[model samples]
Target: MDSSSPASASPPPATAETGRHAYRPKLRWQPDVEEYFAAAYGRDRFALISEALAHPSCYSCIRVNTLKSSTDAVMHKLMDIVSENGLSVGINGLDIGDQNSGSNTHEGNSMVHKCPYTGLENVIFVRGSGPHVLQYDSQPEQSVKEVIVSRKCAESVLRGAQVYVPGVLACSAHVERGDKVAVSVAVEQAVEDGGWAVDAHYEERKGLYIGQGITAMSRAGIFHVPHGIAVEMTERVYQLPSFNGTDILYAESFAS
Candidate 1:
């Protein structure tokens, strides 16, 4: 979808706090499970691992189908895509081979590197930089266009996936196609009824900012469609080079 200024008279921002860091759910484990892990790894180390699980991978790995195309060809194609998108590219961990030479690719802010290990020539890595600062543009008079998504949806979006219609929890009123919108995930809390309830209000404290995108459908269309992309993300707070809307994914069996 194309990107444009958000429509006026949109809903005010949510209760979620504004920041570059992703809003992640706290991990809860059974008493025995926590004890086992804490005993194996120190409590501090175990905590670190748990925290990391809440975030996306720092790098994306793509495995090329050697039967369909060579690694060099895919590398060149990926570099071109990243460069055209105005993201920097760099070659990393390339094994010595005429076809996989670093000089063959252009350089920029983002990085694309070959698998460093042997026997993994078909695999490539695209480095993702993240937690970059984002401005939600929230103000008292001027409202920011927003789309609230499920916790699961936000997790995927942070890891380079697009916002699908089914994952959308709410959309600001008057959000039309091509409008720029801030995306956040609804925080879930357990209720006395034993069911879960999400913080639906678009408050910085209620949800967390994942990134921004251009809507492919209007507020109504998003709910009308059973399944499809609702938002084409332009910026992810945790940046992973995405090949959505491009043939790069189909042409290669990318599994990252």
Candidate 2:
């Protein structure tokens, strides 16, 4: 699906060339197929479904390797990881470790919790929050280094994946290791040459700000390397706990 800006309250203005309405999330479906679904599910319902599918799941599920570790052990390790990452172990105002008191619990937010079901003691749930209001151009006087990634990469980043070299399409001039960069995506678009292009030319690019990260490689290194992580994401528009370097826990599944 074409990822329209999730933070935008409305779509961008119509294009002057085509004079068509603004882009909408349609999963790049054929006209007839989209029409069929719209008719079957009603236009409004189909639109809702398309928008929802473009976003990531709200929570990630980590099924503990019970043979190697206990649930409490895994939980404490996750808390430690959160602390190492500089993320709050608290939900709302309550600490993640304090489960005894319900007074400070946030209604819709949870840092982490063990599965409440009878048979799923080893299942741990990590809650995520999304559609955060990001201040992209907060410092107008300072030039922000930018990295443009593929749409697929941007989507994966929203789901808590780091930016890899292969996914990087463009990087700002002078971008070097340790540089903080604004990460965006270069969505595919038709070209006059009867081909599609995903090149990232800042002003011409139609994309959304997914997150910010510190560069692991210089601009030259990113394009030259065959494969490796390019950017280490520090802040994401949709916040999710990444399980990349965890020892005994991995995101076994996602809860829609």
| Candidate 1 lDDT (Cα, 0 to 1) | 0.67
The list of candidate 2 runs beyond 4 A from truth reads 1-27, 89-94, 97-109, 117-119, 190-197, 201-207, 253-256
Candidate 1 lDDT, tens digit per residue, 54-149?
666767677776677877887787776656654553334332233345344522223777877899877777766666666666454666788877
Task: Count clashing residue pairs per candidate.
Answer: 18, 0
Query: Relative to the true structure, how large is the alpha-carbon lDDT of every model?
Result: 0.67, 0.67
lDDT of 2 by residue, 1-256 (tens): 1222222111122122331111222355667999999999999999888888866776778888888888788877776665665555455655654643644332223566788889988888877776665555556565667777777777678767788776777777777899988886667777799678764653444336777889998887777766788899988877776777666776775321
Q: Assess candidate 2 and give its lDDT.
A: 0.67
Give the TM-scores of the predictions, in the order they appear. Answer: 0.74, 0.74
- Tell me which residue pairs clash in candidate 2: none
Worst 10 residues of 1 by lDDT: 1-10
